[model samples]
Target: MPQSINCRVGCPESEAPNTETRAWSESRKMEAMPSRCLFLLFLSTCKLSPEVVAEVQESSDGPGAQEPMRLTDVQAAMEFIAAAEVAVIGFFQDSEVPAVSLIHSVVQNFQDVSFGISTASEVLAHYNITGNTISLFRLVDNKQLDLKGEDFESMDATKLSRFIESNNLRLVTEYNAITAIGLFNSMIPIHLLLIMNKASSEFEENLHRFQEAAKLFPGRILFILVDSGVKQNEKAISFFKLKMAELPALAIYQTLDDKWDTLPITEVLVEQVQNFCDGFLKGKGLRQNNEAKEKTSKVEL
Candidate 1:
């Protein structure tokens, strides 16, 4: 957490956020660098990596619109999933089923989420799926979230969209009502959180560095962004004992142990973030463990 920005740097205390804590959206706040916030918006347009060599699921409508791809072989399925951080595969008995059409519609709606259709019995049995299912694969933590049973039967575009929103865990998941559930319920033990106001000017720089650092940990840690400026996010900031005054900061939360540590940061750099994560892994960043454990009960919810 930051103490105060120097007036010589153009940020004055009078202009800082008050107790009410309205998000600082003014240009003055941007001039002072406290580090930046995370970008991957938790909901931005997720772009597929152009460098991916595997053939992605072609959208049913065609590659012109980038619609869902039809997949039959298990090997092709694996390649489609491997091409992106998050992908959704629809396993149906056949393409004529009503659910398949509904899935195609829903797939078109979420451009950022990858989608594929598989009707082969071999593919279905490979995943132990007996019937129609929509599987969301998040390679970041190797978490496979599924939508099936009654929900899959009555699914519509709106319902399918909600499923993606709630379970779409990207490289750096942002903190919000939707993602909060996914994060807490995640089996991943340690969470690397970035607390900064998205409205801040340095948000892009900080987010880029955070993403780079995330690449180093993969399934080991889940990186989360908690925006200090959003009123709705005050609970998250407070959950980590952070004040909006401290616009940009990073913290590590160990869900298994209910402990956390705040990384003292003057600027958000890939190397610095990497060091913080490495230290935590080596069991060196638990100085505030005792203090943060008390709040673990609330976090458990």
Candidate 2:
């Protein structure tokens, strides 16, 4: 007959392994039991079906995983602009509809994004009355970023003047009420255009030097020479036209203004053009390489 057995509720019976064996066995069992309990807990907590988990695991860990493609510099900016195209420019109107307009815009001068719309548009009225809020989305291939910001009713004239000077933007006329009001109410994008005057041989030579430097790093230079003089000689105009035609890549130009306009050729425009050109070159190189690779692959296949 078997010996009478007495085991406490939490204690293992005598058939359990002896001393060291029992401890090891108990430890292993404890480990296994917890794992099993945890697995059950995981199953219960997950909302995903077993099939979905299996599919994801197979895709992520198996041969199906693929590296994501990166966007080239130009492509990234273009993608951003394309995505932001339909962005709303919101303006407050006391009248019937709180006016909102969708405008097409471009990211000009690298640093500031610009949009071209008529100054006399309804948006101007709204902006004049109660300021404005603009919202847009930026996307580069798979990446996305949203932009939302407000426009001030009036920017300081002195500040604007400084900005104009810094950016090389030549104002058509001197600081006047009309110009001030136009700037105050205008929703001109942050970008400014630089117009350089090529009145002298020295100026032309400097322009050429700048162009050469830019070519050393293509897509890294922008020079627009505007001939703004009362007695503009045909030789000078012809020379400018020829130069512009020759150096199509370099942003060279002559101004058409009879009165000397300084605002058109601001430093801000110069900086922006430089940055844009650099990005453009980089993007172009990437695209060309990609094309070459595709061609090679096709030939091999």
Q: For model 2, how does the per-residue alpha-carbon lDDT over 83-129 read when each residue is reduced to its tens digit? A: 22111122233222222222211111212222222222353332232
Give the TM-score comparing model 2 with the true structure, all chains together.
0.18
Listed in order, each prediction's TM-score against the native is 0.74, 0.18
Name model 2 segments beyond 4 Å from true. Answer: 1-115, 118-151, 154-158, 168-202, 218-301
What is each predicted model's overall lDDT from 0 to 1?
0.63, 0.25
CA error at residue 300 for candidate 1, angstroms: 29
Highest-scoring model, TM-score:
1
Off by over 4 Å in 1: 1-66, 287-301
Q: In model 1, where is the ten-residue run with the lowest total lDDT?
A: 1-10
lDDT of 1 by residue, 1-301 (tens): 0011111112122223232332212111321233221111122223445532334533323462355677777766666676757778888986787877777677666666778889999888777778788887767766555667776777777767766765677889987655554555455667888888788788889898889889888667889887777777664566556544554778887765556677646568998888888888899857453465564432121
Judge candidate 1 at residue 86 and give its lDDT: 75
